[model samples]
Target chain A: ELKVEQNPLFLSMQEGKNYTIYCNYSTTSDRLYWYRQDPGKSLESLFVLLSNGAVKQEGRLMASLDTKARLSTLHITAAVHDLSATYFCAVVNNNDMRFGAGTRLTVKP
Target chain B: EAGVAQSPRYKIIEKRQSVAFWCNPISGHATLYWYQQILGQGPKLLIQFQNNGVVDDSQLPKDRFSAERLKGVDSTLKIQPAKLEDSAVYLCASSLDWGLTVGELFFGEGSRLTVL
Candidate 1:
């Protein structure tokens, strides 16, 4: 079974601060994805890291994948109130896709 | 292009009652997925279909849950004799190709189920 673990499940950060949400999985796979969901809304795809050392960024968020370590990270730079939402990382292994427990972020001004 | 569409955004039912949710995937999408998301957790894949054929359904609770995709276009998920633990959001997703290699998924606003 593939297991995904995310750190800092609930985060409260000041606006303009920087933080990283970590996703660790127990499988060897090259495909990983990041998604964001607002309260009572559907998931919005953020980034798809397909290779080791692959990094993708959009706005204040950057995501990277390290396949050898079975780890991925979503970095938030200079967060804003609008970035407050739940973020999730999903990994695909052997045709099975597993998602980590989401990281809920709250930005305060 | 239209995104994945789901009906009955919210549903409230008594335990042991039956309920069904519907989904219409993006046009030309060959892969469809159904996920169950509980509060404070990530979405869990319950079943996946590839062009009207089931690809995976290992995680679905077979005794009380059933799903089908007809004509490789629309899908429906039905739950019979629901329990309180079954109260969660049911999400529908679709992709252009085989899901394993393509990680990008278009998701619908999930149907929230509440069992009383």
Candidate 2:
């Protein structure tokens, strides 16, 4: 079974600051995914890290994976109020995908 | 191209009542998944289907929850005699390939269920 864990289940950051959310998996996984969910909305795909050292960025968000460490990071660069949302990281081992507890982010001005 | 579509955006019912949610995946997608997301938690996969066939249903509560995707394009999930613990958002997602594929899974807006 693949168990996914994320650090700092709740985050509160000021606008224009930066932070990173970490995701660690218990087993070896081939794929890592990042998603964002707004209040009362469905989840939206952010990034897909398929290999070690893979980094993807979109707007103020960047995600990277380290397969050897079984870790992935979603970094927020100079965050803004629009970036406030719950972030979830999921890992796929074999054919099963397991998600973390999610990190809820609140950006205050 | 239309994304995943779901119906009954919100439902409020008392304990022991029944509720059903529906989902229609994107065209040509072969994989469909149903997930339950409780407040302040991540989405939990309840069932996954690969073109009308059950691929994984280990986490589903068969005692009270049931789901079906007969034609491989749309699906329905039903909960009978619901409990307070069952109050959550039911999300539907679809992918173009199987679970092992490395791609984004399009998701629906989800149906929120409130059990009193």
Candidate 3:
């Protein structure tokens, strides 16, 4: 069974601070994805890292994948209040996809 | 383009009752997925369909849960004799074939279920 683990399940960071959420998987995967979900809302795609060393960034969020290590990361730079949400990293293996437990981020002023 | 659409944004029922949720995927999407997400947890895949055909349903609990996609367009998920643990958000997502992309999925707002 493929499993994904995320560190710092709950994070409270001050605005303008930088933090990184780690996602570790147990098996080989061709790609990984980062998604954000707000209270009572569906997931919003953040990034798709398809290859090792692949990094993608948008606004204050940057995601990178290391396929060999079976790890992925979502880094938040200079976080803002609106960045508060639950972030999840998922790895796709064959036709099945496994997701991490998710990290809930709260940006406080 | 419009994203995935789901009905009955919220539903409350007593335990052991039956409930159903509907989903309409994006236009021309070939793949549809149903996910169950408990509070403070990531979405777990329950079943997947490929153009009206069952593709994967290994994770689904066959005894009380059932789902089907008809005409390769719309899908419905049903749960009977629901348990308190089944009180969670039922999300529906759709995407193109896996070969087209790295399995990027578009999700609906999800139907929140509360069992009393």
Sorted into a CAPRI-style docking class, model 3 comes out as medium
| CAPRI docking class of candidate 1 | high
lDDT of 2 by residue, A23-107 (tens): 9999998799999999999999999889999999999999999999999999999999999999999898888888899999999
Which is the winner by TM-score between candidate 1 and candidate 2?
Answer: 1
Query: Each candidate: what lDDT?
Result: 0.95, 0.94, 0.92
* Model 2 regions more than 4 Å off: none
- What is the Cα-based lDDT of residue B13 in candidate 3? 98
Top TM-score model: 1
Better of 1 and 3 by TM-score: 1
- Indicate the residue-level lDDT of B14 in model 3: 100
- Residue B12, candidate 1: alpha-carbon lDDT: 99
If candidate 2 were superposed on the true structure by all CA atoms, what would the RMSD be? Answer: 0.9
Q: In candidate 1, which residue ranges exceed 4 Å CA deviation?
A: none
Per-residue lDDT of model 3, residues B13-116, tens digit only: 99999999999999988999999999988999999998999889999999999999979999999999899999999999999874335447999999999999
- lDDT at B44 for candidate 3? 98
Error of 1 at B35 (Å): 0.2
Q: What tens digits encode model 1's per-residue C-alpha lDDT throughout B1-116?
A: 89999999999999999999999999999999999999999999999999999999999999999999989999999999999999999999999988567637899999999999
Ranking by lDDT: 1, 2, 3
TM-score of only chain B in every candidate structure: 0.97, 0.97, 0.95
Error of 2 at B36 (Å): 0.4
